[model samples]
Target: MSSAGVGCLYGVGVGPGDPELLTLKAVRVLKAAPIIFTPQATGSKDSLALMVARNYVDESRQRLIYASFVMGGTSDGVWSEAAERIAGYLLGGEDVAFLTQGDPLLYGSFMYVMVKVQAAHPTIPIEVVPGVTSITASASRAKMPLVSHGERLAVLPAMYGIDDLRDVLARNDTVVLMKVNRRAMAAVSQLEADGELSRCVFVRRATTPREQIAFSLREIAPEDIDYFSMLILSGKKGQV
Candidate 1:
């Protein structure tokens, strides 16, 4: 990774919510990179990962590039427009670091960028730096382990349909459900009916100042949970 070798792309993970949980390597790459790109949903007012990185970034030097948008173009053409802007920086030979809230490759917006960049510039070297995901953070906070002897762990984004959710729960011993929001209540309820809810732990805004942990989903206030939450369910007793 020479400075002049077209300046590689780094998908650096900042960890789930906690700025301090960022790996030393992630920090080093972030600070050294001349261009730091953070993802923001097309209409979002603020970028959470960027806000967390701001706590460590040297404001005087590093240039901030807001790579705003989701994979699908918005009605206002904001998403495609934002992608083009980010592509411009990468094509300009800048060592760009695409920062994400959790491990960059794990359900992070970095995947969208990586795919776009690869299609546009096949020779570009993209590096991925792993960071602790929300599941691990939630587990640590709740003193729960996602894995135990003979226990299989499956991670599913709450975006799954009811059938899919039920199927996964029936198959896996331990499951970590992400992107939990109001829409996920039905699936959560199903988990209870399956006799797995009591073994579940819910962490909302894990690792941040607003962090909340609930041993049972029933204990969580309906108005409190949003997409930022994660649910960790353990299997049988003695599995941990």
Candidate 2:
């Protein structure tokens, strides 16, 4: 396709599970784009990102593209494939928007696709729109302050293991743990051992229909944890 016919690409963050949390710029871009792309997990019925963005996008006027991207899988092929599919639309001069569940740069699959697409088509224009992250949403839903003045904040993925979790907990005034699915109990155990369980708050699927908020880790069952769950540990306690 000719360079003149190529369209711009937008990486839009739909926000943490809430459609209303979507930024105005994100909605504007979604409305203007001719095509929308969202990532779906393998064997999933629908894309969560797309579900969050459905209210803003005009489905009848825009074409939807669902790309399969498995979580915790060690492979770059899926990202490359998704990029190529999006490139096809861009080559035809159709502006494309790729929706992500949270901030596109924070533990999101959009970064992988963005890198691949940009590497292959350096000249194509691209933009990234930030959104409300799960950390902030969880804090808000739990009615807790993530940090106060002069407090250090550290965000870590639970997959990094318990040792790192302990270290961060000791040093940071506020620690946000993300992707704590199967590791929920392990994380809880560590916090309990350190005498920090009382300061911990757990939130699952924040701001969504399935949302669950726990003031204490003990209040949540291991089976209740989901991939979208997050844990917040503050050195000081807040109203629960």
Candidate 3:
């Protein structure tokens, strides 16, 4: 729990889709926070991060704040507005926690809010608690090693065009493609063209109830994948 005199801001990663995967520190801070903020995608009723951490949240004691973040667009204004709302709580000397899925620093929207909050309130105490990333979770559930001794691993978002993905596939021993929603088939096609589809495994919503794994690209249709889907590509074939 934070001290009484000054309020603190905590950026907490609730881990990837699994409540049990949350760190002890994340639980502690979330419990202690008087106000909790979770990012809700525009048009979404609930935030995924909040859902992952709901078991640890005491709604009666903690005030829940939902901040709207528009996905796949310029979110500077959204982040700024969220920061402003959090700034008000900090000024009132209330400890606030912002919950995010996966690690706060890794492709999480919390980073955007963090920067803006820091810029607005430089003296406010802030801490970031790290959690298990989806990449590692997907790899673990698939029973595949992301990289071996001397093997290089590359992590990329599928939005980085097919040409760039092809170049990286040519250079790296292992690659993890994240944010693979509608682009799943395109990625599968690219891997197949490179003769690497056999070594690729597709995982969706790792560690969650809706978790799905496809060892062969043929088993995965683009329509079946969600925004949380990821593909782990290995240089060797028949690994899965």
Number of the top-ranking candidate, with lDDT as the measure? 3
Clashing pairs in 2: none
lDDT computed for candidate 3: 0.84
Q: Estimate every model's Cα lDDT from 0 to 1.
A: 0.76, 0.83, 0.84
Sort the candidates on lDDT, descending order: 3, 2, 1
Candidate 1's displacement at residue 99, Å, is 0.9
lDDT of 2 by residue, 32-55 (tens): 998999898888999999999998
* Winner of 2 and 3 under lDDT: 3
Best-to-worst order by TM-score is 3, 2, 1
How high is the lDDT of residue 222 in model 2? 77
Candidate 3 ranges with C-alpha deviation above 4 Å: 1-4, 236-240
Q: Give stretches of model 2 more than 4 Å off.
A: 1-4, 159-161, 235-240
Provide the lDDT at 134 for model 2. Answer: 94
Minimum summed lDDT over a 10-residue window in model 2 is located at 231-240
Local accuracy of candidate 1 as per-residue lDDT tens digits, 1-240: 445567688988988888889899998998888888887765788788987788767768988877656533332344355456666766677788888888877887777777777877787778998988887888898888777799788987774566666566567777788878777766776656667544878898888999999887678888877778888865444321
How would you encode candidate 3's per-residue C-alpha lDDT over 21-105 as one tens digit per residue?
A: 9999999999889999999888988899999999989998899999887765678888899999998888788989999999999
